[model samples]
Target: MELEVKPRIYVVRLGGDNPKLSTALKLVRLGYAVRIHAKEIPPHSVVLNPFSREILKPSDSALLRRYGVVVLDTSWNSGLEDLRSMVGRRRYEQRVLPVLKAGNPINYGVLTKLSSVEAVAAALYITGFKRYSLEILSKFKWGLTFYELNKEYLERYSSTKSAEELIKVQNEILRSMGLQP
Candidate 1:
């Protein structure tokens, strides 16, 4: 059974001066439902956050299909305040993607800090839209690197049915890599 992504994706850019070559902007060029400096957020959508405790799992596909996904576009340096402000603006279901390596030049091989497009693609992949995820990642040269590095983890996360199970698996993966969970 192929799961379809229903809710349109919405991105809110806090204040990072748009870079000349931006992954988020690349996502926009690829015809994704991206909105920069979005003023309003749809209620009940799954908002992607690196800091959120609620792990995004394959089981959340139902919700993604129903309410769509929202991404917070901010720089790692100056976006935290913006994220905090946006959190209270609307009632959104926050979710964090499982452990994954970055393919972006800035944070390649870094854990958990994924580019905006990578985060969106990861969510799409974990939720069973593998093709869509790949299609989105194809826009960047380094995109494939992200997939190659985290393929196993992504596959593992995609196979889990619940957030709890995914979290347990993520913990194990972290431990194996000599990282503290």
Candidate 2:
């Protein structure tokens, strides 16, 4: 039987703040991901950018399978300057995750404040890699909670074929929650 090849997961740890609590660092330790500098991100890989205008879709799975995925691990306290520097002119494809509540201890229940691992897992899940996504999240104590909290949204988002569809689903979810979309 031919061995299956998994997409590479890369995390760029900015400023190295609170390494102990870093889910991205934990993933690296568990041998599920790699630590790399911002400049080292492979060309055409999907870079998780919260500031990105483009929303991630199931179609992007092809890019993830071929060029892999990247997440920038940084402190919320770290100013946008750090993030802007990395995302400003990068060759990588930048895509943002839809609004989802955090499940990590630090920012639990807060919208769009997922931990690094949560962000990576969300990307994988959105791109049709549910098994790998759960496997990565299983490594964290509060990992599964992230999935539980966002399962409805994840399921809906993953089924979307395009960014527009994903946005429409996100809006519907938000409207149902009585929040302005």
Best by lDDT: 2
Q: Which pairs clash in the backbone of model 2?
A: none
lDDT agreement of model 2 with the native: 0.87
lDDT of 2 by residue, 110-177 (tens): 99988999999999888888888988999998999999999999999999878898999999988988
Prediction RMSDs, each to the true structure: 1.9, 2.6
Best by TM-score: 2
95-138: candidate 1 lDDT, tens digit per residue: 87888889899899999888888999899899988888888788
Q: Which stretches of candidate 1 lie over 4 Å from their true place?
A: 4-7, 36-39, 88-90
Question: Model 2: runs farther than 4 Å from truth?
Answer: 1-5
Superposed Cα deviation of residue 96, candidate 2 (Å):
0.6
Q: What TM-score, to 2 decimals, does candidate 2 have?
A: 0.94
